[model samples]
Target: MQKPRLIASDIDGTLLDPFEQITVRTAAMIRRVIAADTPFVLVSGRPPRWIPPVADMAGLDGYAVCANGAIVYDIAAARVLSVHGLDALVLHDVVHALARVLPGIKVATERAEPGPDSAGAPFATEPGYRNPWGDAESNVRPRAEVLGHTATKLLVRHEKMTSEEMSLAATELLGDAVDVTFSTNRGLIEISAPGVTKARGLAEVAELVGVARDAIVAFGDMPNDIEMLRWAGHGVAMANAHAEVLAAADEVTAPNSQDGVAMVLERWF
Candidate 1:
């Protein structure tokens, strides 16, 4: 098989291990690929602030499809290359309407905040429940007053309800105005701007890099990653991936705990 010129990967459950850390083997493989001038993109539902550490760890200096494709970020430059956001008015209306339907549910907006380093701002003051990826102490903040900034994505966290239930409620309430998907197993729902997704984000990155969509490979392991996986020339789903993701992909790799991404790189490179 012809090797892809670019690789895009979802972070949480596809590239990272169970503890959310990238394995040494994966890191080395990423570095090797980057050294070979292959652009490795980290396409994820994570906010811009939470992406740098992962990018740095992987030795990638390309763009990140953040907030499920609501924002495409130039990671090396620490700037937003493009953004698809919900207008302030629409965001407020949706939040309010969702609150009425699912009382006590946490509603948070993920945005780029000024960071302490040259890597740009991290996701600041997410208003919803704690981050479900075990980074609660870093990403969680107290509920605060909502403002009128453009929202890259809206996150809903419900303790007693399943993500499927919350997603259905959101669809019923908001209809086609927003796109919703879940990346974690913690019943959190991520709502993005209509028509925006990680696949679209990868397309944008591919355009900027002058790489064709058919020259890119992608890895993912959840429902949120289905479109991205299907969009790539070679889509690889982790062994532990959702059925939908597995069915959509071109192939399956080892589980995340076993360094599935690294195994693919080893075999391909």
Candidate 2:
């Protein structure tokens, strides 16, 4: 492969190891890649608040595509370069539709705080909806307060349905009015504006950085990463990737715990 111009990677199960930390070897590999003048962009289902810490771990000042593809973040500037958020009206409608179809469903919206403290991304979620990991610096409030404004992404959860099942259901009900995807945690579905995905976010970054689609390499391990993998010239899946992601990828690497990302970059940098 002709060396990649832009390297896009997913966090959690893709870049960080099982411990959710960037290993020293992985950090060294990232530094080497950055030294070669390649831009590393983190595209994740996470909010911008979770990105700065990961960028620091990589030992580079990089940008991020947060909330799936809804927000593009400039890490060093601590600014949101662009955002594709659901309109307030649309958000309200979708929530109602989901409630009608899935009674007692939990709804939460991820709002980008003015900033983060020693605390991490200041998330405003509904009272009952916790993250996939069961831990986040989340502020739980009444649904009235949570759904009153436009948001980057919405989390829809049900006690019985996995995110995968919820994703299928939401897609069937909402169709193109909204974009629905999920994470490793199958408990909740994350909603974005129509047509937004990791690929769309990466495309924006590639344009901003002047990298062609063919020269971009992306790594991912979930259904959310499907479009990004398809969009990249070299789309790699983690060995532990979801079945859909593994099938969509051009290649599969070792598990993230084994420094799969670093092992691949070594071949290039």
Q: Of the candidates shown, which would achieve the greatest TM-score relative to the real structure?
A: 2
TM-score of 1: 0.87
Report the lDDT tens digits of candidate 2 across residue range 128-241.
Answer: 776667755677778776777778898888877777888888999999888888886567888999998989999999999999999999999999999999999899999999
Cα lDDT listed for each candidate: 0.80, 0.86
- Estimate TM-scores for all models: 0.87, 0.94
Instruction: Summarize candidate 1's per-residue lDDT along 1-269 as a digit string, tens digits.
Output: 48889999999888889988888888889988888898989999887877899987777778888888877887888777787887667777787888899987876676654334534223434454665665554444454433255668777788788787787788898888888888765768888888889998899899989998888889999888988888888899999998889899999999999999989888667
Looking at model 2, residue 55 earns an lDDT score of 85
Residue 104 lDDT in model 1?
78
Q: Which ten residues in a row have the lowest lDDT in candidate 2?
A: 113-122
Model 2 spans with C-alpha error above 4 angstroms: 113-122
